[model samples]
Target: MRRMIVLGLGALLFVFPFYYMFIGSLQAEPDTTVTSVLPDPGNLTLGNYAEINEKVNLGTSLLNSGIFTGGVIACTVVFGVLAGYALARLRFRGRGAVFGIVLLVQVVPFQLLLIPLYVLIVRGYGLADSHLGVILPFAINTTAVFVFRQFFLQLPNELFDAAHVDGAGELRVMWSVALPLVRPALLTVVLLTFIGPWNEFLWPFLITKQADMQPLAVSLANYISNVAGRAANPYGALLAGACVLAAPVIGLFIAFQRHFVSTDIGTGVKG
Candidate 1:
């Protein structure tokens, strides 16, 4: 009973902030000064959402987010899988050194690389104010590469041997034999990569000043600072933006939760 109480309390503690944000977002007025995190049932309204809609073109922002996140996921998957397969299965010169470099890159904070990356994307390449500019930098994620490499390594060597015996080239074997068994890793990387690019406001903000081209996070950030505070219910509008930003991420995780299990790519090999 004690354990159940603790678990329940922990769960509630984790969820209460989201609940508070949702409740505050629906209220007719901002609840910034209110001591209670719980909503007052009598005062609940959708007016804050309506107010936010009037101030920002949420539809455009959502579309931009789709484009940006989609591009990043696509590039991350293709290149990450290829690089990972090469590192895991292929024997090449300086392969260990290259892997070491990948690991080293992960230890460095993105903030440390931000200035140089910005200069290259903006001044060097002259790609400022462009979608390609925003998407290009995040295309190949090191974390995604690492995740794919680990998954590929878990694959049994016999699987590759069988494919090769059947006249399959390395690329064909990677695509046909290896990838099918690592669905979980793909989903994992997709979700991991999705969260970062989807929620990222800074790089996109720096790359493009045009509101139409900016993702939902950037637009919501701008609204929070510039327009949301000007509204009658600043806090409510702010929470509403948070809700909008969080909804898709929560939905994707829920949808993909079933696919998170490992398939043990070597199971067939041992059998």
Candidate 2:
């Protein structure tokens, strides 16, 4: 009906820019005086993709990004789960204070912490020009901890009691009983945390001046800012770099979107 048509138009508007960018990346460099949103089929070429690799080592940048983002994801998953489970289930002094502090961390802008992180990770720790240094500042995500804690809080207390009565240790209880039930939170936090370190340019650029150590974002940024306009097909080359930078994240979400459905809490508890 009319509503369906409206929704279709909205979707088209949302998708048009991406489609435009992809097509533009396949195009030959256009003359500055010429104006057309669509590229001619005859003018389409893969030369732009080849051009981007020359300006930045795409292979090395991807490897660097994988190492950085993967490390952060692993560390976040392990630490977020531990802290969240403790906050939700354990009896301890200063639990409220700890949770409050975690919440307070989310309120502070990352920019405010940038200076201290630079000094500590770069100068104090002497980890400059290293993958560990790039990964250090983002190892634990406070927002992820809060998310895991909330998800743990939502599960039935009976589940924990049953595990405890069975003489399960705390780690055993978490891994076997509680962790299985929070798959949605894991996916969400992974995706959310992925975006931060994946698209991160400033921190990585600041951490290392070496070209081989830079992530895709930093290299692409350097390309777009300094070298793109000098290319024979500047616009196409720029968009091609963007496509490379965005492809993995978009593919990940598409692959994992099916698992992002709501969790059925009642199913986790046994009679």
Candidate 3:
């Protein structure tokens, strides 16, 4: 009973922020005090959402976010899977060296490369003010590659050998035999990749200043910095913008949470 109480309290602790954000967004009047945690139902209103929408075109911003995030996720998955499969299943010279370099790259913080990346992407490549500019830098995620490699390594080698003996090519083996068994990894990489690009404001802000091209993160940042203070209900308006930004990520996680179970890859291999 004590353990159940503890777990329930922990769950409530994690859920409270989201609950408060939702309630605060609905508040007609700005409320920051603890008393506002449980505001009167009569004080609730949708005007905060309307106000933010008027200030920023939510649809356009959301669409831009989708395009940028979608492109990144697509590239990350494709490249990550191929690179991972090669590292795990294929014999090649300098494979260990290459994996070591991937690990090395992870140690370097992305912020350190910001200046050079901005110069090359914007000035050298002339991709400024374009969606490709924003998506290009984040296209090949090393972390996703590492995750895929680890998952692929967990699978039994017998599966690959069996597929090869059946006259299936490398691509065919990966597509037919290997890919189906790594559903959990695929979903994990997708969710991880989604969060980075979806909430990324700095890179997108650097890539494009065009209002229509700006993603929701950039718009929300600008709104909070410049316009939210001017709103009649600044607290509610800020929370409303946050709600809009967080909803998709929360929904995706909830939908896919049950599918993160580990696959019994060894079942295919006989003792």
TM-score of 3: 0.86
List residue ranges in candidate 2 displaced over 4 A.
Answer: 1-13, 31-35, 257-271
lDDT of 2: 0.83
lDDT of 1 by residue, 1-271 (tens): 9999999999999998988888888988666656657667877888877777767677888898989999988998999999999999999999999899888876777777789989999999999878899999788888677778989999998889998999999889988999999887887777767877798888999997888888989988999888865678888887887899899988887887674445422110101
Give the Cα lDDT of each candidate. Answer: 0.82, 0.83, 0.85
User: In model 3, which regions exceed 4 Å deviation?
Assistant: 1-14, 258-271
Which of 2 and 3 is the better model by lDDT?
Answer: 3
Q: Model 3, range 17-58, lDDT digits (tens) per residue?
A: 999999999999877777888877888999888888888889
**TM-score attained by model 2:** 0.87
Clash pairs, model 2 backbone? none
Candidate 1's C-alpha runs over 4 A off are: 1-6, 31-42, 257-271
Error of 1 at 17 (Å): 1.5
- Total clashing residue pairs per candidate? 0, 0, 0
TM-score of each: 0.87, 0.87, 0.86
